[model samples]
Target: MEDSPRSQELLSLEAIYPDAELDITSYSGTITISIHSADPVGISFAAVPNTQPLYDSINYLPPLKFFFQLPETYPDTPPTVALLSLWLPEATLTALHASLLLIWDDFRDMVVFLMVDHLQEQAFVLFGLDPPIALTEVQFEFFVSYNREQLQEEFDTQSFTCEICQQYKKGKSCLRIELCRHIFCKACLLEYFSTCITAGDIEKVHCPDYECTKRVAEERKRMADPKTFITSGTSTRDMILRVVFTPPLSLDFLSFLPPEIVTRFQTLFTRDQYEFFKSNFPNRAVNCPVEACGHGIIRDDVNDDLVVCPKCRYAFCIHCTNSWHGKSMCRLAVRLDIPEDVLEQYLSYPELSKDRRDLEDYYGKFKLRRAADAWHMDVLFKEMMANELMTACPSCGVVSAKMDGCNKMTCHLCKTPFCYLCGEFLDRARPYDHFNDPVSECYRRLFEGMLGTEEELMRPIAPGFAL
Candidate 1:
């Protein structure tokens, strides 16, 4: 027995689209045709009226489904076709339906294949709409998500060679880095990144492919500015900026790693970024004074000592590291009044030693610990101020800090010239001669302790100063 024309058409479609659902007996089925373009197509979405549209580029769109029932008359009578899509407008669907009917009317033969071919080729330019198909916010979101899902699905069904292991693997067993689109087996990525995170090598957490890493590094170097340089010293501000700016790896690939490893990666990456920001912008960056909230705060006004921590909203004076004292002299000279000798002796003993215990008992543990904490904080405050903030004038012994400029400094009180780096008195007639002299340690090091220089600031910070 020979098959009917309708059955033959259905069989041919079934062969072409193996995944399509078809009923040979009923001569009815649904088939999906994916839209593809040689170049990426632009899509724009207007979230609200009178606003510019958000734009994105993609190479794929959601598949268009064709539902058909072959009539007994078949090619002579054309199959009934209905077009359906998640993202296409109703009017576009109606137009597509009319186009399919025209194709059948002109061909008067098996036109399903022709319709599918026309859709595949013309989808991007359908209705003569130019690039950047305009869509509503909801439709845009739906199309993007659907497109991504389709791409992922397609990837998962294929096989690739992982560069890391040099082994062929199914896409489901591999992980793709979103930034570089490099693929590696999940097991290899897990082991390699986990080791890096555990060893505190946050920089190695990026794509392991040599060419990819080199390209990324070159790009980063090209984008490098003074702000990207990190110093050796670590601080609370450094950590905060790191956490905010430099994530360890893309979150998509991080899922392949253990939770602990992911956490470690984040910690190390943040710490690294924090160190860089702290090193490059010492004067502009200060740690929040709150004991429990030491977030980094970068200042906009160099003269204003007032700082408000973004993390804790604790407003404080940068110089005093105390609660904000608006328009008033910093009261940093105030101390906890613990006897120096007692505080020294208490600190010399090991924390758990009997000597420390005996001192704790004699001074009363709570009182002694409180005094010790205050003393330690004062010492830290002094160190930070000296190392990063202020320098004492060599002639009058007046303490001051330069917001920015060359190494040559002048005493505001005595009007004596000096070198800010070594605090040595400069020749009155030739103050810069000190730095220009090759024999002088400060020679050619005027910018030392600034963003790019390797040398630390050399200003002498007095042990005691009145504010």
Candidate 2:
């Protein structure tokens, strides 16, 4: 026996939506139709007022599932149908359901295909609703996630030729950079990005496509210019905030890389940013002294030398690069490790003396030359005993000797205070705190080398004991 018209329609619907769930005996089925827009649709949240709508240029929206049952005399009678959607409101679904029924009234024969087509094409714009769809926050999130999943699903089924390998591959074996939308095979991208990161070429770790890289550079140039934002009516404050908050483009494609590579890329990227910052603002930027966390910190106040590293929460003086001192003077931190006698002896010999040449051969010629030049003027003025007692300021490199006071000696030239015993930089705010901290190597040794009738030096340098 030949199938009935309803059975024929069910078979046709099954053919049209291979993934749809259908009950052939009962003549009932559910077909999910994906809504695609020619132009990217805008999504906005009604909960977030006054903010710019998120314009991700989303081409796919959450799908609408059509649940329908064919009546016994389906061609003559309208089909019973309902629209269900996770993102769309109940009122919109109800309107869509009515629209589906109206289509059945107009084309009573084989209306499922026509209904599906109408929904696919007009769902975003139908029923007096247009683009920039305003939804609740939860709905908006669901829509975005659903759209991304659908897009990935579609992409995974398609075939594309990777520009790098010049070979056709399925989307599952490829990666599409989110910023530039340039596609490359996963193997090619992984190898290329891994090499760049391993070589510390962090700047070259972005999109490998030359055109995309150039376009990104141009975009960055445009963003850097204040006039670009001004011409577009964006406030300078907004432009600054955007530049400061926006992550680098290299970070956008990290999903394509392995976890270890991603970590290395992040570390290199941070170091690159720190170098760039230091180059641009030499005086204002200070390097954190913490060996493990050497992030660059930008100083807000020039007069106040205290700097707190944002990444490590380490509070140190900018001049001394040590723990923040409450009110004590900053101590000289210059390391005069090479003996002044050795440096003077090296300088005493003629430029071509065999003795100097021998010393230069033992030590690097450049090293001895630089050391001699650095201490030449200071050695000429101060005596040998005074030179041994003196410590140079870490900031200005000027030598200052301690005569009869505490270990904290301030440079006469640059006025930078330093510990005379160890030449460690002292914070101007609370210089004695360095000696008071139990973990410090110089703790309680502030007056260790001092002798004679200095009452302050004889005083105990302990916790809570004022010197």
Candidate 3:
């Protein structure tokens, strides 16, 4: 089968951003692409849209980088479009990944287009212009035409205005209120709902005008459920694909295609990834560490740290992706050896870093440090690694016991001793004086300072007394 005309145009874009160099991976029989760059990340579609002439469809300028991954076989299968670096929230991203399972036979171009159209409408409202007449991606100049003026006049006369505030408007940043044959600002509706009104409290947001209540309620119900935007057989997928895929195309409507296209296409690229652990160490039951947890994580669940063991209080480490060690009674020293390396390696993998970081930020409260032994070891390590003692003079390095005792001492090196107390190099003429020498005023001061005065030092203190 020949490449779709739309596919050709997108292929040209992919030619610039190929698969090999971009850290693309194929795991569990599905292609996965990583988007780590600070710039707009990208995904390539294997087959480009093949409908209209490439030149004619060249007008849309998408901010995200787009790409296609074409399998060797054509038309018999649909290509996957990878959306790069788009600012989607984690929950939304998880939803999108799950939604990909229902594509069946058509490319989701329509759904993408609808979302983009909605976003563009939002942008227009934000820019202080008269609302665009249609929810489509038309050039900015198109909104400047005579129809805009007519739409503006018609909209101004409509009952879309908030009745309480008497402000004529369609929608605001936070609210979207609609009345009979018109939409009101969401901000106004919310304000009216929470505050006192002449007609009792607005239990649910209602059009200030009583005539629009039924229509507004119906629309509000649909908006409350996010699932309405994308579902198994709905046009939501079609609309979403249009925004994510440039020049949307319906593969099911193609003139030629395979008989089992839907089944085969659905299975080839999954939006979901089921997880199970494989053991690297001997006899270890390589499963999710959550106690009594036989159930594994679905791709969507991987986004959160609350991986509860279906049967118990066992929660796996979302960071190290290990069993929960925080709840155990082992001392810190004992638990410190809990092969954190595997978790480190898994996290260091390029694809998992961003995801790991996000999970870290979300579950920041759960870092476990329960082991007392581990705490002791940590203190010892820190003391040994203190900055001041990390290095020493070559001559006195091994001989001097400055690490544990008073600094005043002589180095055995070269028989040319130095005052460890004063840190002064000395010769036989001014040979170091021991405690017995009357001229050893420095030694007397040092001993007095460390051991206290003879009278006070002679007195014993309590066993637990601290210096």
- Residue 407 CA displacement from its true place in model 3, Å: 8.6
Point out the higher-scoring one by lDDT: 1 or 2.
1
**Worst 10-residue lDDT window, candidate 1:** 223-232
* Model with the higher lDDT, candidate 1 or 3: 1
Kindly list the per-residue Cα lDDT of model 3 for residues 1-467, writing each as its tens digit.
23553455334433543442321231001122321222221122212354332111111222323233434333344445443423333454444334442342455332322222333343333312221212222332332333334334545555455556657664322222211333445555444533422233322323456656565456435433323333335443243333222111123321122434323322321211111111111111124554455543321222233455545556665445465566443232233223344335334556546544442322221231222234545555456435222223345553343433343455556554555544455455655455435776455533432345564477564232355
Whole-model lDDT values for every prediction: 0.73, 0.71, 0.36
lDDT of 1 by residue, 2-110 (tens): 4877777777887888998898767888888777665878899878788888998777777788888878788999889898887777888888899989999998998
Most TM-score-accurate candidate: 1
CA displacement after TM-score superposition, residue 286 of candidate 1 (Å): 2.1
lDDT of 2: 0.71
> CA lDDT of 45 in candidate 3?
21
In candidate 2, what are the lDDT values of residues 146-227, reduced to their tens digit?
Answer: 7788789988999999999999999989888776788899899888879988999877866789887787578655644423
Candidate 1 lDDT at 380 equals 76
Summing lDDT over every window of 10 consecutive residues in candidate 2, give the lowest-scoring window. Answer: 224-233
